[model samples]
Target: MARQQFDLIVFDWDGTLMDSTAHITRSIQAACRDLSVPVPTDEAASYVIGLGLRDALAIAAPSLDPHDYPRLAERYRHHFLLTGVETVLFEGVRELLEELRDRGYLLAVATGKSRVGLNRALDEVQLTRFFDGTRCADETFSKPHPAMLQELTRELGQDLGRTLMIGDTTHDLQMAINAGAAGVAVAYGAHPVDALTALAPRFVAENVPALRHWLREYA
Candidate 1:
């Protein structure tokens, strides 16, 4: 087998590992309805999946006043919680994580979710042990910013050249670019394959099986 090129693998949570995009889109739309703002189209809602809550709402509802951001965020959380959205990990995700871990690759998460939200999800999935480190947007600058990736690499003591970011969105790829790390894109997540390709990721996997194959062969 070819030597693995990456020692540290950073994952994006939403759209990438978990199948939460539709639930999130509904929650955003519900929040908009609560505030009498125009609900964003499904495309608009999904486009912001990897962004911080406030940043996402702003983009999804650009006409809303900035003063309404806090309320919108609150309503989003409320709606999301009340929706009873089941947390479902993508197919092959657990096996993939386990295989990577067994192969001695360090795993981490850099997500747009708040610290509390990520923690809750991790607990529910019983996946805390799978990740060696994590950075949340509420605790750092949001996605497409290099802060999350930079801090993850720093905390892991891994060089940028030996770290890889895998995510479902352009924001995730752009963040990797900003952090001077290589990236792979998963098309089964938020953005389309074409959009991901435009960012120049090292590889674009169409599904979890393909992702596993790519990681084994090239990561």
Candidate 2:
């Protein structure tokens, strides 16, 4: 076997692992509507999928006062939870994770979800055991800030240079750049393929199978 290039594999939650991009975007739009704030278009709403809820709401509803953020967030959660059960991991994600685990790689998740929400999702999908460590937006700085990856590396005893961050959005790629980790992008997610490609990640995968294949050969 070839030597592994990375020791720690960090994944972004929404668009990367779980197929929750549309649900989240709808929830954000619904929350904006509930607040009587102008609803963001699907593109505008989906663009914020990998950001912390607070940060996402701020971008999706910039016309609203900061004081109403909590209310907007509440509405967002309410709508999200209503359809949360519909979310699922992308095809082949389980097989990929299991293979990685069997091959002795440390796997972790760096997500925009609150700790509570991430736990719920993990529990719902029964995927908690596959991850060695997890970081939530509510617990620290969100994506595009290196804090999540930095903290995960510290917690897992992995080198920044030997870490691989994979996701569907530019935020994930930018975070890897900020953390000095390599990044892989997936096109079938919240951001457009062109946007993800512009980040110059190690590779841009078009689907879960392609991502899995690449990781098998290179991760």
Candidate 3:
């Protein structure tokens, strides 16, 4: 394997590492129903997966009143927390993260989830220990803005050239671009591969196993 090219590996949580797209979509729909607003289609809901919750909700259900955003967000969270939703990390994800950590790479998460939501999910999945740091959208600017990645790199003292962001959406790739960091896009996520490819990521992996291989060989 080639020597690691990145010292810090920043990951996007949903659709990239965790298979939570379905759960999130359902939650958005439920929130719309709760507010008596027109629900967005699954594709529409999933399209906003990498954005901050309020921003996502606004885009997904544009007809909804801004005054109802808090309730909409609350209902979404309520539905997401319901039992049996079964949000889990993609297969091989834990192993991949562990291997990267053991190989002396610093791992972190830059997510659109709120701090409370991210913490709960991390605790639930037992993945908190794997990350050296985390930045959440509620605590900073949302994706495509680069504030989250900027903060992560600044806090970790990592150079932009030696930082890599891996995610499953154009928003993620754009965030990397905005941060001046390299990115790898994963296909089996919210955005289609073609859309992600247009952003010119260093590589596009079709699955978790392929992503692992790419990181091993080049990242």
Candidate 4:
């Protein structure tokens, strides 16, 4: 069958749309410090992007005592939300989303963040209005699970083939493939460009501007 034209553009929230890298890492570090565990480096934190908070905490603090994970999770959420005021949207991301919306594509967010965290970030940045729907790991499953993507498609009554998933992580790429949708990986975010490219995305954008251009031409 011919490739279907896309009507829906799904985004990954954290690293792709929002530049919460430092906030996330610092919050995780705070959580570790609260538990007397060693903090992870920024690179290590990057590897945990697109994972649910529970899973991310584990990956970020692998040496932590297992029994303390729940407490760590709570501490991370509290600290992260407090420090999130410092987080900002990626450069050109708002314009890109506006461009996509203006061109009549339905926009949604599929992220590994929980509903609370996702909503907080969106509300903090006042970016929630741009998206028609948001699917978070708390609502379904984490990246690479396809659960959120499937739920979004079902809720929106859109054909899976007519959806495009854009993110900066391999998990997002795998989620798109799992959902039988088009994957476009952004290079200027969390994952290295080469890593995202190796996932074989339909398109790999070097930055938000390039991604916006691609949406104009293809999505």
Score each candidate by Cα lDDT.
Answer: 0.93, 0.93, 0.92, 0.84
Write one digit per residue (lDDT tens) for candidate 1, span 95-206: 9999999988999999999999999999989899999999999999998999998999889899998899999999999999999999999998889889999999999999
Write candidate 4's Cα lDDT for 157-212 as tens digits.
89898899999889999999998998999887778888888889988988788887
Better of 1 and 4 by lDDT: 1
Deviation from native of the Cα of residue 211 in model 2, angstroms: 0.7
Worst 10 residues of 3 by lDDT: 1-10
> Predicted candidate 1: what Cα RMSD to the true structure?
1.1
Which candidate model has the greater TM-score, 2 or 3? 2
Q: Where in model 1 is the C-alpha error above 4 Å?
A: none
Error of 4 at 179 (Å): 1.4
TM-score of each: 0.97, 0.98, 0.97, 0.91
Q: Find the 10 residues in a row with the least total lDDT in model 1.
A: 79-88
Q: Can you write out model 2's per-residue Cα lDDT over 89-108, one digit (the tens) per residue?
A: 99988998998899889999
Task: Give candidate 3's whole-model lDDT.
Answer: 0.92
Candidate 1 lDDT score relative to the true structure = 0.93
Model 4: runs farther than 4 Å from truth?
1-4
| Residue pairs that clash (backbone atoms under 3 angstroms), model 2 | none
Candidate 1 vs 4: which has more TM-score: 1
* Candidate 2 Cα outliers beyond 4 Å, as residue runs: none
**Candidate 2 total steric clashes:** 0
